[model samples]
Target: MRTVRYSNREELEGINSRPFLANHLRTEVAVHLHSNAEPSHNARGARVIVQPGRPADARLAQSVLCSMKELIHSVSVYADFTVAPAPHTGNKGENREAKMPSIIVETAFHTNPDDARALQDPVFRTASMKGVEKGYRLFSEGKDCVPLKAEPIDGIHLSAGGSQQVDVAFEGNPQYPIELVTTNVGCPPGWTCTDGRVRIETPDTKPSQLTLRCENAGSAPMFWNTQVVDDDGVKSPPVRHWVQCIRGPGGAVASPGVPAGVEAATAG
Candidate 1:
């Protein structure tokens, strides 16, 4: 069981390199993990994709999705919590021209509040990976699953060239070396306002707080990906909290824009 990373910085930078490296290494199968989204923010649940006319790819896709189906829980009011009826067919740059079987797993929709909350839970991360392991013990598995909840922060409006202290709080028996990251989505094009990564110095299991700085150089929104990582290197699912950076005058950097409904602390 080998792991492959297509890009760093939580952004899609080296996508085409996936199939290239897989073919170069002569890997037997390829699996891509991803979260889904849509403009409506109503879509939820997990699904898989494969290249058309490939039997091996189809089987691998089904095998993994079946396992994920059992582990992930749906938050959709419409009862859409299972994998798609069949593997979706596509010729994406990451899957096309691969000499071996390949499949892409859409874990869940980050656009939905319930699904997004589940994605950040450590228990959900562990269980989802276990499902993938079972799927692979047999190709891999998907996440609206949660055992830990990170308080949600949104509607955070900031001014260009202004900075704010973001306090991220969550509930769980967290292990040491927790890592908070920012995903590729949400930030404006060519903007580098995200803090990128921050480490929790304390190892408290309850009422933990992670404070970091987020400065805006452009007018756009940002989503911070928060996760708990044990010393063993296992990572919890990411909790993506949103912030809005605005470009205008009269906005103060020191005046915090802490939104309502979130339990957060301000760094003095």
Candidate 2:
């Protein structure tokens, strides 16, 4: 068994250092440990124990587990709560496969508020060596391993058309840049705004509509502002526009534009 501890900041850096350790345990250690043990009695195989502190740590653990699954397809997992590890042991006793050489990790310390406070700490430089040592010991003894899934992010809605600007808010790993592109509906493909902000031309022939797309250039969520301007160099009015991408089924989602006369001639 192999045990690993992860920090929120380091995991966010896009490094999967723990998976390598898990691979080492499974191929290098588990094969040998199982081969020497008798087959009639249940023999516990090696496992990977991960101790995650914050929500990000859990996510990183899931990523590491996913990578490990790709390499060692038959590894079992169990999550031992730091607060009550004893209760979970009984639950695992019912399943024989779970009795394999597993790794136990202290993902978090509820007693220490400082560890929990690290979630909001801007300078995430501290390391939880205690958790690491415990996990390593559990993995060495083949005690407890658990599987976990990553959490999802909140959705965003953006609308920019008919001389109206839109702003979209995104929260996630901030290392990535947000790229926004705007294109007019039923217009020439060449007619588009590559910049984050978009300015729409109220077509003389018909009411023109444009779509704004926001995407992350890297592995993090990004945020940007959208501004619309008219040919007269005046700021456009705040119009309620439906974000097509977020809208469901029917195309009835529309941003009713105020009459041209109602808008002030001056820039908003």
Candidate 3:
């Protein structure tokens, strides 16, 4: 299933369902993506769909559940094979016929408002992708889950005519090299965002920094969105930071020591 779903096809059968999923069992670990619905429209969070007796698939589900839980606290994972008719199983032909480990990721419920909102958010979507990718990596590569984090800054009240420094450090496991891409978010004109720049890429090393210059005259808040992009082109969610800039008249700057409520959050 390369896309979300095929509307032209029937529920239980489809003409494009060729090449046979069982034929690719040795080469591909089938992972189906789906969204749920309920009459109450209150079902929320995430759920995992996996057939019983598959230990590796269960592990994959758990990893995804845990990683996503870091962003969405209520996310859940469970084995679902409770179907109808004579089978009475929780899974279907996609995973049931495969010889290798397979799972279905119920990302979120479409019926719920909160889940729908989260589904539309780029940040949340990226996090879910990272969780799924990391889940597979944990099961297949046995690699460590790279803890991607960035520092927040505040009190960037700089002088109206002088330039102020803006630096952010990206830290995580060095084994998994990452490239942090930062872009300006709602930065005003004449108020140079890192000197009229938009995108900055972090070096492929641990504790990399994005050095920016808050130059020119401005009296507005500055926001930036940074994403951790891996070598494989997979990006973690987004880590956002904002600094209230008030270019005072006397050309004097205040050293923003420790932000008020600044905390680090993981990027996709």
TM-score for each prediction? 0.44, 0.19, 0.46
Give a tens-digit lDDT track for model 1, residues 62-102.
76665565444322232345567568888776677678988
Clashes of each: 1, 9, 10
Best by lDDT: 1
Per residue, candidate 2 scores C-alpha lDDT tens digits across 1-268 of 8876556656533233333444555532211110112333332222223332233233333333332322122111111112222212212211212212332323333234543443233322112222233233334444443422112212235332223333322221111122222222221122222222322332321223233342211121123223233221212222222222332222212221223223211111
List the lowest-lDDT window of 10 residues for candidate 2: 28-37
Q: Which residue pairs of candidate 1 clash?
A: 120-238
Off by over 4 Å in 2: 1-60, 63-162, 183-268
lDDT minimum window of 10 residues, candidate 1: 251-260
In order, the Cα lDDT scores of the candidates are: 0.58, 0.27, 0.52
lDDT of 3 by residue, 226-260 (tens): 66555434444566766565555432221221232
- Cα deviation at 124, candidate 3, in Å, is 1.7
